[model samples]
Target chain A: MSEVIVITSGKGGVGKTTTTANVGTGLAQLNKKVVLIDTDIGLRNLDVVMGLENRIVYNLVDVVEGNCRMKQALIKDKRYPNLSLLPSAQTRDKTAVSPEQMIKVIEELKEEYDYILLDCPAGIEQGFKNAIAGADRALVVTTPEVSAIRDADRIIGLLGANELKKVELIVNRLRMDMVKRGDMMNINDVTDILAIDLIGAVPDDEQIVISTNQGEPLVGSDCLAGKAFENICHRILGEDVPFLDLEIKTSIWDKIKEIFKKN
Target chain B: MSLMDLFKKKNSGDIAKDRLKLVLISDRANCSPDVMEMIKNDIIQVISKYMEIDAEGLDIQITQTESEGNNGNVPALYANIPIKDMKHTGPAR
Candidate 1:
């Protein structure tokens, strides 16, 4: 069965596009036909992130407006034959595509692909509404920060109000060292407040920056974030994959306690 | 700083969690703390018109609680208004 999932974060720059690209690629690597749609119309980046910016002959606006066939607009990734991208137009704004149009586009893709991942634009505006219109499930990506968590909570309420009940969370950019030091919010702290099923927790890794800059999905790399994304893909496919171990090493306090016990 | 002070200093994670707890409750209720206070006062005024109520012991809060069955957590408005005695047994004031 095909699943239309919208990857959204109420706030921008929280790795929505990166998550969409990596997860879609991960699914494709797992032999599933996947299409990643960039719904951030005016500020299109998914195409660039996927390194398909040069081959975009048609975009989402073109398909929705009936200016081009859906197949013609889909950019196939040479790396993963099963993976494709529907890039958004840079000239048009969010209002260019309505929710009904998005549903129509998604429905058509649903028949051809095993998974349809929509990279929703930031905020709960027209863009966000359009992204979630035809989605059967939502993957809310958030960082371990106060502002991001607050916005994510708002988005969760909005999704519930819209009747998108199959919502899960992805805690992105978690720094284990900072979490150990109590400087960053841990996974439990985030999930407790969000109160959604956690599908993945990706630690903050510098390798993600390198992979993203190279227009490669981190899932194929040996980086920690890449492994986490792959595990999330497996979990999405109904496999009972264990979460990545992000525990920090024993702290000085714990070491001192161990010494006292040995005395 | 003392070792105790270091432990006592609220970490950013705890601070974020506490702030999110408060904000999420208010956001779900679609009312601010001040608005909740106003609503509590209004409820008290209406109830106290006919009954001797323990206004001091009244409590009104927007809390998060899990729904019955497989449903997830939901925001709920809980009001605890204690009634001391009936001020008027008549039908109307």
Candidate 2:
């Protein structure tokens, strides 16, 4: 059976979609049959980020409503033959699909795929509930900002309330330069507040924006954050890989050397 | 000595004061290391019967101090309750 993982965050715009795209792509590149389900219905962007938006004729709602079969709604990724996408319905709301329906869908996909990724919507509403209902594990994404961390903590509390035990942290959109300047919170600072196991840290890369616009991820490239996502995927697959050094620890000497090098 | 040295010396004290303010705020607010007006309101509610406290001048804080053993420690909470300002209508008890 495929390991159903839900990528969610309490707050919006913290790179949930980007993390989903990268991790899902990374797992697919590893020759694992992966299916990503976008549960953000009516406000879907997972397909756009994955570069499979045009191929979405039948979506998650269609399958749930019995309008189409699950196989028909599942869009195949040309980049990775094993990667597929179950797109969200743009015309319907999240309530169109019940949690039990989602469980059934995941269970069916589990037989055919090695990994089933659920891209959850923002906020702790019905959409969030629907997205995490059938998942075996969850990845709580948060930025270093106070608001983002607070929302993540609230989500962690909610996850515990639901008896979901295997939860991990994914610190996204991290700015190393700002962290070094003490203008932003560090990883330890964030981890200390959340008090959870860390899975991955994706550095804030402008290249991500370019790649998203281009309808693909920067994963498999030498981009620092992309490499970190790949590492996270490997770790998820029970592979022991060294964590990326996304933390920028700059000393007085290092600063001076950088200044000297700039001249 | 350069003026930069003098400013550094002055800023060192300011930094300590700033850190003290932050630590106190964190303790009182139980959140980010910044003073919030909600803490002032809480202090007002606690001391309203005892004395007519100046909500604006009410200094509530947490002071985070360095420890030799631990790298980072939780800040200490300090609430300055003004006992002298308490109204004594009768003989002092």
Candidate 3:
């Protein structure tokens, strides 16, 4: 059976969709059969983010409504043959499908895939509840900002309230330079506030935006953020990989060396 | 006073007592810094009920000592509400 993982954040625009896309692609890159389901109905953006928007003929609504078979709605990725996506209905609302319906859908898909990734919507409303109904574990994504960290902490509390045990943290958009200057909160500060195990820390990289815009996830060793995503995938598979701190280090030796070389 | 006498300032018990007194007052009056500022303004308004209030020099602050352990803990809030000179001395004034 596949392990259903939900990537969620209570606060909006905190890289939930990006983390979902990259992590799903990372798992697939590891030769695991993975399927990503976007549950943000009506305001669906995952398909567009994944560059699979044009290919979404039938979506989650069709499968739930019994208009089409589940296998028919699944869109196989051209880059990774083992990876697929089940896009949400762009015209329907969150109430279009019930939690039980999502659970049944995942239950059926579990037999064929090794991992089922759900890109959850923001806020602690029905959308959030429906997204995690069928998941085995949750990857709570949050940025380093105080508000985002507070919201993530609240969401973790809610997940604990829901009896969800396996909850991990992913700190995204971290600026190591700002952290060194004491201008932004570092990973330790965030972890201290939220009191959760850290699984991945993705630095703020311009390449991520370019890659995201290009509809190609950065997961290779060549891309810093991609390697971070791959490391997260490895951790998810029960591998203990040491986390890499992406913050820049400016030591006196390097500064002196730069001055001497310039002179 | 000897060097020890100079160090013989208030002990932990005394400090804790002071802190407890202030904390109790603040807790009862539900007074915070923000609330205290509003209260200071209200005090000025009420003092303007009878006498003039020096708003420029007026100061209101709450101080509290936070300590750990039962042996010696100084925890208290000290509020200093200082009002400047006014013409009024008595109720009649």
What DockQ do the predictions score, one after another? Answer: 0.65, 0.09, 0.04
List where candidate 2 sits over 4 angstroms from the true fold: A247-263, B1-93
Position A235, candidate 1: lDDT: 90
Query: Which one wins on TM-score?
Result: 1
How do the residues A1-263 of candidate 2 rate in per-residue lDDT, one tens digit apiece? 57999999889999899999999999998999999999999899999999998888999988988999898999999888999999999998878988899998888898999999999999999999998899889999999876687778778888887888999999998888877656677787778667788998889888899999999877878888879889989989988887777754366787899999999
For model 1 the local lDDT of residue B2 reads: 81
For residue A223, model 3's alpha carbon misses the true position, in angstroms, by: 2.4
Single out the weakest 10-residue window by summed lDDT for candidate 1 chain A.
A246-255
lDDT by residue (A178-260, candidate 1, tens digit) is: 89888888999899888899999998889889888999888957878999999999998989988888763356786899899
Writing each residue's lDDT as its tens digit, candidate 3 over A40-118 gives: 9888888878888889889999999999999899999999998999999988899998889999999999989999999
Ranking 2 against 3 by DockQ, winner? 2
True contacts kept of each: 0.90, 0.00, 0.00
Among residues 3 or more apart in sequence or in different chains, the pairs in candidate 2 whose N, CA or C atoms overlap within 3 Å are B23-B62, B24-B61, B24-B62
TM-score of each predicted structure versus truth: 0.83, 0.76, 0.73
TM-score of chain A of each: 0.94, 0.94, 0.94
**Model 1 clashing residue pairs (backbone):** none
